[model samples]
Target: MPALQYWSFLVAIGVLVIAGGIFAGLTIGLMSLDETNLAILKLSGTVEEKAWAARIEPIRRNGHLLLVTLLLANTVINETLPVLMHSLKWDGYKAVLISTALIVVFGEIIPQAICARYGLQVGAFFAYPVRILIWVVYIIAYPIARLLDWILGHKHGVIYRRSELKELMALHGEDQEGPLTKDEVSVLRAVLELRDKSVLNVMTSLEHVFMLPLETKLDRPTMENIMKAGHSRVPIYASDRGCIIGVVLVKQLIINDPDDAIPLSDIKIRRLPRVTARIPLFEMLHVFEQGGSHMAVVYDSLPGQTEQPGESSRNGEALARIVQPTWTYASPRQADSSGGNVLGIVTLEDIIEELLGEEVRILGSTLRACVRVYMEITGRL
Candidate 1:
C-alpha cells in the first residue's frame, strides 16, 4: 500500500472498530429499555429523561426489528475491520489478531458498559442514525422480524400484577434508607390490596354495634349512655334489632333536654347506604364519595337470589327477604330495603383503617362532648 493509502486504511479500520462497538452497545443498551420502561420514563421521568424516552420509544416499540438491525450492523462493521487491516498490507493472522483485540475491547466491552448505564441518553442521541440504519437494512431485517413476531407472538409489555406490586412494596419497605418509609410502603401495599377486600372483611356486626331502639326515651341516663359509647353514629332499629332502619348522629343529642323524656324516634336519622356484602371496598369507596351516608348496611343475599325491581320498605323495616342491590349507591333520604338480613355496619373509618393497615381510633362525639363539658365546668369554655 502507498504511504497515504496505508494511513487512510489505518483510519478506516479505527472508524470501523468504533462503529462496531456502538452497534454492540446499542443492542444491549437500547433493547434493554423495554416498551413498558420507556412509557413510564416518558410519563414521570426527569425533563431530560422524558425527552429521551419520547425520542427512543418509536424505535424501541418494534423490538424484533430494532434487534435485527443493530445486530446486523455490528456484524458487518466487525467483519469490515479485518478486511480493511488486510488492505493496509498487514498479514491475515496479524490483521485478525489486532482487529479482534480492538473490536472486543473498544467496540464491544467499553461501549456496552457505558450504554448499559446510560442507555436512554445514548439511544436518544443516536436515534436519528439508528432510524437511518433501520431503513438501510429494512429489506433483510423486516422478514426476519416478522418471522420472530409470528413465532413468538409479538412481545407484550410486562406489567406488575397486584400481588407483585405488593411484594415490590414489601421489598421497598425492607430498605431502611429508601425514599419510601415503611409506613408509606404499608399504605401503598394496602391500596393495591383494597380491591380484593369486601365489606364483609371489615364491618361491625349488628350484635356488636351500639344501637338504640326507636321506642327508647332519650332521658338523662340515655344521654349519659350515648356520651359514654364514644360512637359518632348510633344505629336506630325499629320492631326487630336485625332490621336497622337508620343511624342517629350522637352529636344530635346536644340539643336534648336532660329532664324531658324524649322518644328516640323524635330525632331525625340519617339513612344508611345499603350495599351487598360482596361489594369490593374500592367500589364501596366510590359509593361513599357520592355523598350522603358514609356508613352502609351490608347484607348477604340468599343463594340463587338475583336483583328485584324497586326497593321494598314496608313501614320502617328493611325487607329481610333476599334483595340483591346493584353496585350503585342507594339514596340516603329514604331507608333502602335491603332484601336480606343485615349482616353488619360498615363505616367510612373501616375502609380508611383497611387502607392504613392499622386500627385508627377516631375521636367521636362522646369524647368531644366530654371535653366540652369538662371545659364548661372549669369555666374554660
Candidate 2:
C-alpha cells in the first residue's frame, strides 16, 4: 500500500511535468508559424489544406488567449510539482532539486528547441486541443483579452502589419538551420513593400507609349509602326493624350478584316480602368483583377488634376509630344497635371515582375558573365 502511494505520487509528478512541456511547446510553435502561407492556403486550397489553415488561423489571431493559458498553466504546474514530489515521501531538498531539473529540462529547453525549428508541425499537433483550451479559458481570460484589445486597437485577423513583417524577415535572415540566400531575402523584402510602391513608379509614361488619334489616316510611318508595333497593346486617343478611349492589340492589325484591316475606330476596345498614381501596386492589382483588365491608365494625382509621367520613368522627355511620336518617345517630363497626360501606364507584367522580383538587364554579353563571377568571388550575392 505504501509502495502504491509512493508510485501514485510519482506518476502524478510525471504527468503534470510532461503536460507543462506540451503547453510550453505549443506557445513557441503557434507563435512562430508563417501566417502568410496559412492565409494563402485558406483563400485557395483543397479541403485538407483549408482544414489546416482553419486550425492554425485561430492560433495566429487569438494570441492573447494562448499566451495566458500557457503562462497560467505552466506557472501552476511548476509551483505544484515540488510539493507533489515531497508527498512521494522524499527529502524536501531532493524533491525541490528534482522538480527544478524536470521543469527546466523537459518543460523549457526541450520544448523550445523542438518548437523553434518545427513550429508549424508542433502547432498543428496541438491546434485542436489548444483551440478547445482557448475557448474554455476564454471565461477566465476575457478581461485580459479585452485589456489587450484596448491597448492594441484590435483589427480582426491581422497578425502582423507591413513594417512588423519587414523586421521579422530581417530577424530570421540569419537563421542557421536553412538560411535564405541574399537574393531570396531581398525579393521577400520587395514583396512586403509592394503595397507601398505606387503605380507612378512602375508605369510606362504616356509619351513612351504608342498611341494614335482616331481620325489619323494610316500614313506610311503610322502603317510601318503598326505593322511592326514593338508592343502588344497600343492606346488610341480621340483628340489628345487626355482623350484616350481604348487600347488596340497589335495583332489585330494583321488578324482583323482580311480584305483591308479594320479601322482603329472600329477595333474592339475594352474599357480602360483608371487607377490613381498614388494607389499602391498591390491594391491596384485587386482593382485590375476585378475589372478584368491587364492595363490601367495611371494618373499623376487625381481626376481633373495634373497627370504627367513620374520623374523616375526611363523614357521621360519634355515636349508637347503631339508629333506622330514613335514607340521610342514618351510625353514631356515637365507636363502639368491639367494637360491631361497620364502619369504612366501600369501593365500586369510590371506588377508581376515587381512581386516576383524584377529582372536586372545586363549590357554586353561578356560583362554579364564577369558580374556573375565577381559575385561568386566576393560572396556579395
- Model 1 CA lDDT for position 240: 76
* TM-score for all models, in order of appearance: 0.84, 0.53
In order of listing, the candidates' clash counts read 3, 6
lDDT (Cα, tens digit) per residue for candidate 2, span 138-210: 7876678678778985544447778998877776676655568656777788888886787876888887877
Clashing pairs in 2: 207-329, 207-330, 207-331, 208-330, 306-337, 307-337
Candidate 1 minimal-lDDT segment of 10 residues = 315-324
Q: Give candidate 1 misplaced runs (Cα > 4 Å).
A: 89-93, 302-338, 363-371, 374-381
For model 1, what is the C-alpha lDDT against the true structure? Answer: 0.78
lDDT of 2 at 355: 65
- How many steric clashes does model 1 contain? 3
* TM-score of model 2 (CA atoms): 0.53
Misplaced by over 4 Å in model 2 are 31-41, 44-49, 52-62, 117-303, 306-381
Clashes of 2: 6
